[model samples]
Target: MSGENQAKGNAQSSKKANCCQLTVDEVGLLKLKLTILAVLCVILGAFLVAFQVLSFMRVENAETERMLIEQKNRNDDLTKENTKLKTGLQETERMLIEQKNRNDDLTNEITKLKNELQGGKCADGWQYFDGSCYHFSTDTKNWTESRDACVTMGGHLVIINSQQELDFLNARREMGDGRSQRDFHWIGLTDAEEEGEWRWVDNTPLTDPKLVQPKHTVLTFVSAQYNSHSTQFHWFWGINQPDNYKEWGPQDCAMIFAGKLYDETCRSLKRICETKSCMAGV
Candidate 1:
């Protein structure tokens, strides 16, 4: 019985030692599993943080892109406006140049007109019209003596060229220098060289004898009336003028009295002279 009891106790002690070893191994395995799980949790958390940062970065990039597009559109609008302004400026410059040119042309035209007006002036102490010069004298002389006086003064007796000249002389007669009532002026006309034939001092024959001579057979005559409104002289001669009537003896020379032409004796009378004329500045 004592030998049996010792053997049994030894067996029981071996069993208890085996049980403790098994318990220690199980505890070490549990510790290793916990450490691995902790490491895996840390790795998962790092991945989640990285994902969130990536999403934020994407949002920032999208906002930046939108701003860039808006800036580009504004730049485009500014460029178009600049182009339009440049075109307008060019047009305005062209119009200003045209206006300046027009002003210069008008100035030149006015200057030319003034020069023409000043160039055609007549000389002093002489009346000028249609390129001719005239001089009226107060002294009295016979027709022949009057012509000689005009020749000495570098001129000739007055020659009635056109009716306009006749009107001009009539206007002078009306202005009478205090001697119009009885004053008569010797003109360059006479029928002295040939009987009933009138001629000027320059020997130009009378083409229109009605202006100076009248027939004796005519019962009535017409006289000239000056029409101020028309600036012309209309003829309605006096009754039976220039009839070469027997009472007026041997009338050869012509003279003017009160703006009327008359055949008169070559007696003393005022003389009118004419000369070749030149414009002052021409």
Candidate 2:
């Protein structure tokens, strides 16, 4: 009986030993499964991190694009502004040049006028057209005599159409408080043999014009003097006094108090010596 009891205890010990071994095996398997789970979690976490990084990169790229676009727009705007400023500067330069040219022209004109205004007494009359001086004598002579005198002086008896034209002939006569009126002026109009029928030596018809008409109208008269003159027929003659002003001499014709021609009577009348250039413009 003691032997059988000893064998039973041994078997029990063996069974206990086997059960501990199984427990150890089970613990090892559990540890292996936990390790696997940890590894998987690390892999998934790495994938998430990579995905987040990619997403951030995409966002950064989009922002960069937007910034690039904005920069391009700003560059375009600046370029346009620069071009506009350049164009404006060019226009300003052009205007300045034009203004300078105008100023120069005005200065030249002023100088010329100052010089012309500083001439002699008869120089003022000559300046009427060609900047010449014409002197009209207050002496009386017959028409033929006056014409011959004008020829002798390289001039001729005066004709009138406009006051400026008359200025060429009469030299802007103002009568000077009626002192010059006591003297006479030689005019181009003459009756000669006819009454009220006047003719010019130039063969131009006798016409008395008013001033400054419209497009399709008759010749107009404009007086250069300050006084208001009666709108009367003005006659003129070309200078032949060696191309000088028409002066009168008594030897040209017979003397007369009054005759067939009133306007023709060069008995101390206003006269002029004119050039063709002066006649064409006015």
Candidate 3:
């Protein structure tokens, strides 16, 4: 009976020891699970922080790119504007040069005209116009004698070359006031060679018949042969002039009286003599 009691006590003690060991194992497993959970939480927090930082970096890069694009656009605009300004400046300079050239040409033309006018001079006792010299006679003579006298003086009877010359002669005669009864003068024209055909002293043919028309139509007496004239040939005629009247016996010569011409006898009359410059001579 004592042996049985001892064995039962021993079994009870062994069972108690086994239960304490089980309790210790359960505590250690629980600690291990808690440690693993902590480690997973730390890893999740670190991942979240890294994601946020990466997002900020992306945003900064995008903004930098946008600024660079704007700067490039501004640079392009400035370049275009500079090119336009350069072109405008070039055009302005060209226009100024062209205007200066035109002014220079005008100045040269004016100087040339002045020289031409100043160079046209006549000898003493002779009036000058367009390079010709004219002399008025103080003595009277027949047509032949007058012509001879003009030749001796190195000139000839006045031959009308232009309407301006005619006007000048008429004005001169009016100013002379040296005639009585009639201001008749012997010119260098005659029809004595051919009866009806008139000739100048220089032997040029009298073309333009309208030159001797009536005084009313005389103003329209520009040459029919010439379309335009810088100089003109004309005639001044009296009333019923050059009639070839038998009453005025053998009137084949022409004479001027008071700027009007008439067929007359080669009697004594005042005359005009004309000479040309060496450069203007035939």
Candidate 4:
């Protein structure tokens, strides 16, 4: 009975040992499975993080592209404006140059006209219009002598038809010194030849335009009047009675210097010849 009991106990001990070994093996297998699961989870998480990083990088790249495009548009706008400004500046410079040229031309024209009217010794330059040289007097003589002198010179005395004609003669009075009948003056008109006929030495009839009262027919304050018969005088000069250089010539003849019809004088009056002239235009 003792042997049998020992055998039974041994057998039970063997069973227990086998069960423990199985448990340990099972536990180790479970631990290995758990470690593999943890590793898988870590790998999945890393993949998700990497995917998110890639997505953010893509978005950043898109935003960068947008900024670049905007910057490019702004640059293009500035370039266009700069071109427009350059074109405007060129146009203004051209206009300024054109105006300067026009001004130069006008200045030249004025200078030329002045030299033309300055009386000179061409003698032909002294020709009278309205048949008179009253604006300028060459010398003094009696009214009778003046008429005769004008006749001989081929021109009659100056007859003032209007105030304008008178003014033209008066403006040039700077040429002479003697103006008074104390400096006896010469005149084309007189009761002398035809009394009140008032005929020019040229024999042209004289009509009083302004009709200064008590006026005569061939009234020549200065040398030369539109004569019915003749029309020119040279070598003969007349004077204003008072030697007045104003437009109201009433000059027997007068002295004129600065401008046209520049008659310079004769202490001794003589008869000469001349043809009537036009004021620059007549």
Candidate 5:
């Protein structure tokens, strides 16, 4: 009975030892589990911080790219405006150069004209008088033929404007033999368009009161009328002048005969008196 009681006490001691060992092993396992949890928390926090930094860098890069695009647009606009201004400036310069060239040409033409005027002389065979040139033909021709000849010589029938001019023409007339009819030269006056009205070769009306005559009135041969107030001599008609005499055909032309005006048939042969501007000879 003693032996059985001792064996029971030993069995109780072994069971107590086994239970203590099991408790120590469980505590060590709990400590290892806590350390693993702490390491996992640290890793998660580092990953979250890295993600935030990367997102911020991406946003900044996008903003920088947008700014560069806007700056490029502004540079392009400025370049277009500069090109337009250059084109306008070039066109203006070209127009100014053309205007300057035209002005130079006009100046040269004016200078040449002035030089010609200063010479104050007509061509050879042309007599210069009162800023005009005169040509006297030695050939005989009818009134119409005489006019044509004068035009061919670069002049028209003579128009006597003043007493001095008529006197100059009278001094140059041909004097025939005393027994024969007086030599006559064709003048610019004519009454062919209308029987009563008279005009000059230039289509100017006869306005000089001294030279006007009563229509169809026969006049006696007389000297020219003198104006004492102006100290000038005026034209007068000869005997039976401007009668429209049909015996020798219609007398539609005028002639300077012995320093007097006379109506004569256009078919009558006569000398020519032509006058022109001095510049015409030049």
Candidate 6:
């Protein structure tokens, strides 16, 4: 019985020893598996962080490219505006130059006109009156011959326009040294084209018949003194003159005697009166 009991105890001790060895092996294997799992978790976390960083960089690059494109567009617009301004400025400069040239031409024209107005003159031995020159011929000739003579002197027969001009001619005639008050001088008036339609040498018709009245009253002083009696004289015509007198072969010309006008033969000899515009001086 005692030996059997000892064998059973030894057998139990061997079984217990085997069981402890198995437990140790199992714990060691568990520790190795934990270590491997920890290393794998660290590698996975590192990969996730790298992926996030790459995504952020891509977003920043996209934003920078967009800004660069916008800046390029703005620069192009400014260049176009600058080109337009330069063209407009050039056009304005051209207009200013043209205006300056026109102003210079106008100034030159004004200066020439001023010089002409100040330098107007007339020939010597010609009387200047009313912006015209007059020449009274001393030689006697027919009406046609007198007119030709006036044309040779660069003038035409005198044309009386106003009462003041007639008065001036009368005063000049009274002041003549050897002129008679009754002396008849050939005038520019004529009716050769049509009877009773008097016209001047300039082709201007007589519009006022009062200028050639047959008679008029004149007030004159009898003595040379200032306190002399005033006398009246009658200006008369030669017996119904300008009656188309056939006796002298159709008198169609006009003459001036004193301050009166008369019709006479065109062939009659008379002094001439010529008139022309004043000449411009150099």
lDDT, each prediction: 0.73, 0.53, 0.74, 0.50, 0.71, 0.69
The parts of candidate 5 lying over 4 Å away from their true place are 1-120, 175-181, 216-234, 279-282
RMSD of each: 16.0, 13.3, 12.6, 13.0, 18.7, 19.4
* Rank by lDDT (best first): 3, 1, 5, 6, 2, 4
Alpha-carbon TM-score of each model against the true structure: 0.48, 0.36, 0.47, 0.36, 0.47, 0.45
Please give, for residues 1-282, the per-residue lDDT of candidate 2 as tens digits: 999999999999999999999999999999999999999999999999999999999999999999999999999999999999999999999999999999999999998876655443233334344433344555546566767676666555554456465553333444342534334455554545453344566656555533211222222356444124333533222211111112542222111111111222234444444333233332
Q: How well does candidate 5 match the true structure in TM-score terms?
A: 0.47
Model 4 Cα lDDT, one tens digit per residue, 1-282: 999999999999999999999999999999999999999999999999999999999999999999999999999998998898889888988898898788888778776654454333114525343434333346546555666666565555665445555445444332345432222223333333443344445555655433222322333435454354233322122221223233543333333222212122323342223344434342
Worst 10-residue lDDT window for candidate 5 reads 224-233
Residue range with the least summed lDDT across 10 consecutive positions in model 3:
213-222
Q: Pairing residues by index, what is the TM-score of model 3?
A: 0.47
Superior by TM-score: candidate 2 or candidate 5:
5
Clashes of each: 6, 34, 0, 48, 0, 0
Which structure is stronger by TM-score: 1 or 5? 1
In lDDT terms, how accurate is model 2? 0.53
Report the lDDT tens digits of candidate 1 across residue range 1-282: 999999999999999999999999999998888888888888888988988988998999989999989999989998999888989889988998898899889888988875555444434545665567777888889999999998888788888877678778767755656766467888988889996788889999866533643444333223223222122323322234444444656778887766667777888888888876766334
Instruction: Please give the RMSD of candidate 1 to the true structure.
Output: 16.0
On TM-score, the candidate that comes out on top is: 1
Better of 1 and 4 by lDDT: 1
